[model samples]
Target: MLTINNLSVHYGGIHALKGINLEVPQNKIVTLIGANGAGKSSTLKSIMGLAKASGGSIKFNGEDIVNKPTTNMVSKGLVLVPEGRRVFSNLTVEENLFLGAYLRKNKEEITKDLNWVYELFPRLKERVWQKAGTLSGGEQQMLAVGRALMSKPKLLMMDEPSLGLAPLIVKDIFGIIKEIHRNGMTILLIEQNAKAALEVADYGYVLETGSITLEGPGKELMVNDEVQKAYLGEHK
Candidate 1:
């Protein structure tokens, strides 16, 4: 469970996010969808402490984590699979996955999680010894998500997981997302593909110019007139 209230972020004089309020309940997928420069990624970065928040509160469970260090956030079971699938290019798939569990000392549990991740991503299992950079874009994205899962996150925050992949691969990725949620992982997803994101999300929010403009059930928002016209590319 996560809560963000009155969240604001600024870069020099440029206001990036303004008083954004949102929540991710336990075992649910909450999506934030918007066009470029809408501050969707900034919200996730602020929660992970990657972006400095000028003011506001980011609370995971019950504690305030507005300005907490990124490492601290990871330890608290909050993890981010950033946009662009920033994988360690030179590292082998196995090595990349092991790095995700860097904070944990329990070898047995880490091994178990490694197996689980492999199961979740069979392609990574096949390419266990291959360099991450050599993998296809879809494989690299899978590696990114698999690496994040290795950390055993409580609330997984993913930014644009479907970016740049083929349509079929995007569909596969979203399917995996739904499976992840079905397995009881709470997700805060920021996606540019509104149709795909809303289809998998339980609740969805529309962010515009650094603020929340619409919030509703994912299905409801999917059929909304404005959402249809703007994000879904449908005209009434």
Candidate 2:
């Protein structure tokens, strides 16, 4: 659903991306796995126009969306759940969730999507009226994902959803990712947790520094010697 071709980015003198090429096909989960500062987040940011693209094109569906306004992403059926769960601390949980659908005027559909989000995350439902800052980290992450879903996007891009969380909660988050994929949500996932990300991805890319080093079927990449040695923490 999204295609990035020869995309590059620069922040002053630092060339953060080196003409990386990637694609997220319809109804498929694609992952970019790399270490910190590997330009994984830059790729997503460029797509969302959060970071400026220094060169090349980003095609959503079929049209080029390289430098479009970030505000238009949702209406085009694209959404991003950023690396940090940036929930509104002062807003109640329900208020934060409703804010996700603020762009839309379909009140009934918004309410329906809100209930679905609550169902997907029962904890958020339980804390519906509570201050967002009071929720645990995992709950905040769920809130972020749930908020993104409120837009009813065709393509969902998530950056580092499992960062700084407990292993069990990470597992739960991956399970939720799988569940969302099973229901046909196209996902472009950026993760440092290669094992979990690749295990869930339909396809995977290994990014190094600022370029794509390897791309393959998710299971194939999982067993690749280079992937194992570097990202998967396996010797030999």
For each candidate in turn, the TM-score is 0.98, 0.98
List model 1 lDDT by residue over 149-179, tens digit each. Answer: 9899999999999999999999999999988
Give lDDT tens digits, candidate 2, residues 43-135.
Answer: 999999899999999999899999899988778988999888898999999998988887888999999999888878999999989999999
Best by lDDT: 1
Question: What residue runs in model 1 are displaced by over 4 Å at the alpha carbon?
Answer: none
**Could you give the C-alpha RMSD of every candidate to the true structure, in order shown?**
0.8, 0.8
Clashing pairs in 1: none
| CA error at residue 226 for candidate 2, angstroms | 0.9
* C-alpha lDDT of all candidate models, in order: 0.94, 0.93
Prediction-by-prediction clash tally: 0, 0
